[model samples]
Target: MQAIHKRLQALTLLIAEDDESTLKWLSRVLSIYFKEVRVAKDAMQALELFKESPSDVIISDIEMPQVDGLHLLQKISQLSPNTIRVVMTAYNTPEYINIAVESNVDFYLKKPIDIDEFLVAISSSVSKGSILSEEIFLNEDYSYSYKQKLVKKGQESIKLTKKEVLLLELLLKNRKSIVSIEQIEHSVWQESVSADAIRMVVAGIRKKLYQGVIENVKGLGYRIE
Candidate 1:
């Protein structure tokens, strides 16, 4: 359980469910594993929140007011294809299943939700979602091999230092949201470090890569666009 919790701790999740009791209960349970959890009563509200700030993983009910989960998932897929989408519902109708499949939902859980299965599904989604792509092209010249931790620009290839690689990995993993300084320090340094130190490290990475590759959120932290 501890290992599972740690694995999920980095993810931010959005849950859309119209049932008040179910929403509250699910949110409370999921909050234990995930770093942040946002809840919406309907698909429209979920879509609005997603547009405002996208989540790494989305777990939505199949039926909701205004728009259904399939429609919401479709819009979200178009907006941010990398997001891990999950659908849950009591209805096991063929039409609902077909729609969910067409929406490309990562997981479909039956409602009267099994806690163990739900956790496993979410954990798997978070782990997979962390890697947005096999390779990330920083620009026309520079590209990063996420699996190899190698940076390439044409024929020249440079291997990132352990710290730089870790930093970049962290940024990419939480690409959808601003990773706070505290979180960065804990993840990268594994201890208390000065904010100035963090800034210096980021600056060095920018120098090695390119300017504007990483965006600083003022006092918050950093994010890779």
Candidate 2:
């Protein structure tokens, strides 16, 4: 067994819970272990936070005001497929079970959550994920490593800013289609930014990593292909 508990200290967690008490209690406790624990009082806020900066692992309550956890998890899944998703619900009926399975949820926990069980769920998830390395090659010259979060060209290694990396990843992930300005702002920039600001980032990446690779779609968005 790996030292999964030790890995918690380096990972970031996002918890979406409606109940005020549960949210507060969860934030207070989980903060002790995980390097960063972000709490959202509702699923909408959770979605926004997730868009701003996706968490390594997400824990969401099933029931919410406007949107439920299942829906949120579905959106999160589309946004970041690598993210580990867990749902908590008081009602563990066949309906929810089937929906959870359909949503590709890694684990389902009942309400009145046990901290130990939560930890075990997280540990089990880590154990199941690929231990092998992952690399994304941008071109014959440049390649990126998911583990190192860095791109390399020839013998020199280049590091990217958080926004730069997010922008690069977003564009590369959706290489088939245009990444709309709205999507880029939501995923790459934490807050709203002007088109010029976005262009600057793109220009920087082009100058540094892959020149003339990223394409612009007028009045639409950016794309790699």
Top-lDDT structure, candidate number: 2
Clashing pairs in 2: none
Instruction: List the candidates' TM-scores in order.
Output: 0.62, 0.73
Error of 2 at 170 (Å): 5.0
Candidate 1 per-residue lDDT, tens place, 84-171, comes to: 8889999988888887898889888899788778778767755665435557777758888866887888888877778788788777
Give the C-alpha miss distance for residue 203 in model 2, angstroms: 4.5
Residue 215 lDDT in model 1?
93
Global local distance difference test of model 2: 0.82
Clashing pairs in 1: none
lDDT of model number 1: 0.80
